[model samples]
Target: MEMKNNTVEVNHIRKAYGNRAVVNDLSFVVKPGEIFGLIGPNGAGKTTTIRMMMDIIKPDSGEVKILGETLTEGAKNNIGYLPEERGLYKKLSVIDSIIYFASLKGVDAKTAGKRAEELLKRVDMIGHRQKKIEELSRGMGQIIQVIVTIIHSPQLIILDEPTASLDPVNAQLLKEIMLDLRKQGKTVIMSTHRMNEIEEMCDRILMINKGRLVLYGDIPSIKAKYRNNSVLIEFQGELGEIPGVTEKRPHDHAVELMLDNKTTPQMVLETLVHKRINVNRFELSTPSLNEIFIKVAGDERE
Candidate 1:
């Protein structure tokens, strides 16, 4: 796609606080109509990078182009941002608060109200629309925060730790909204601690650590790069310490193994069978996004 058609472009962006670099020579592209994930461990500079993109903070060097233009007040209306630190007018009614925010994005009050009603209903928050934001629970309030972000129907939406306050059910609803936005040809940048969210929702991901890019690619390609020679086994009783197993984890009903190099699932099964161990099922697979995240973030296990 042409540069003009892209949702965001970061060209060698760099940011610093004092003598320490917060973001170091970071560069990436977010295509139109795709969910792009930005993730890293604590203090990974993910927030700093996002701040630069939003123009909430400026980069020390390089540039960020949003919707083919430098981030400006006019350009700001085209991008919706849901901050990790959620806030809402406590005394204002939920619907009213969202409508007010929508107006700030240049949406008319009437249209904003209508959109708020529809969105609230979709999130199962319609009944509470007229209630004060302080009246809602943390999770319900978070749902409103999402509605507030997109009330004006921005072309690109940035969500930071959006599901932090949601339960599984509400989180699933948020995922549906994300897919719906993509279906409508809008781009989404999501920062989440939930690796499952990235795997299920993101098309591409950029992972950083200590202000440096550690991984940048589509989800499938990154997973393939970090693929492990491993197998999942559902068996009964002790397997008597199978050979070629570098790591073994016993869950409630099964075990997952990390196999060493040159080790194959077939060889593992043969050894199990030879030892007279009962094997119910087994399958070889690549490492999960969580595993890759741990490794990339320098938090891997022994």
Candidate 2:
């Protein structure tokens, strides 16, 4: 409820094009030193919302506050933003492009140049520093973009699908960089459809569907709300209806037993042991963020 201490406070923002409302009455807050996730299905108005937050586009109604104040020309310098769309000066060398972007954010050439070398090395792209942007691969370009985004050492960082062009190794490196930024007390906002990344990196998440808020909360609380009501087991015996399980979903190598509230996973394991079933693996199954995403967004379609 209090907005002053928050890094970002978005209140009742709405945006529409002609007849269709792309973002409708969306509101959320990002706390200082936390990684907040903004997620939704494609065409769910995430980009529209980010654009409004950056003041690249105006919302039909509502307010967006960055670092507790409305975005100003001077305030822009303290924030690092990477939009979904990627762009760079094709003719310029990698180091040149990084310095150019930093200069735009008011970082002097001396400091920017020093920071550029450090960041390029950090991302393992120092060897490509002299290459023109047009000559680099997609993953290489993404690394450069990331370096450019944070070269100025902004207080707040906003990235939309920052790992979209990266390989697994590069993506992992970026994750480390982001985690390091958080440790430095910089606030981060990441917008992506990668549910695994959301669960692993974000402290809180806001999910929108068809331009409307569907789910919003901390990761633990949200998963606890959809608490594990099933158990997965790998066994060799014929799985006749167990006493506590209501339904059995079969797999080629395993079976998931849906449990009633009255039965615990311990009870099911005991039942299997008593029946002489050779249990290789058994554990309570919690709903993954990806499953929850599909459920919430899929329900919107039906």
> What do the candidate models score in CA lDDT, each in turn?
0.89, 0.91
Off by over 4 Å in 1: 1-4, 230-282, 299-302
Candidate achieving the largest lDDT: 2
Candidate 2 lowest-lDDT run of ten = 1-10
lDDT of 1 by residue, 197-300 (tens): 99999999999988888899998889888887788889877777778999988766778888888888899988988998888988777788998998867652
TM-score of each: 0.84, 0.90
Q: Model 2, range 86-149, lDDT digits (tens) per residue? A: 7899999998999999999999999999999998888778899899999998888888888888
Candidate 1, poorest ten consecutive residues by summed lDDT: 293-302
State candidate 1's TM-score. Answer: 0.84
Tell me the spans in candidate 2 whose CA falls farther than 4 Å from its real position: 1-4, 234-244, 261-280
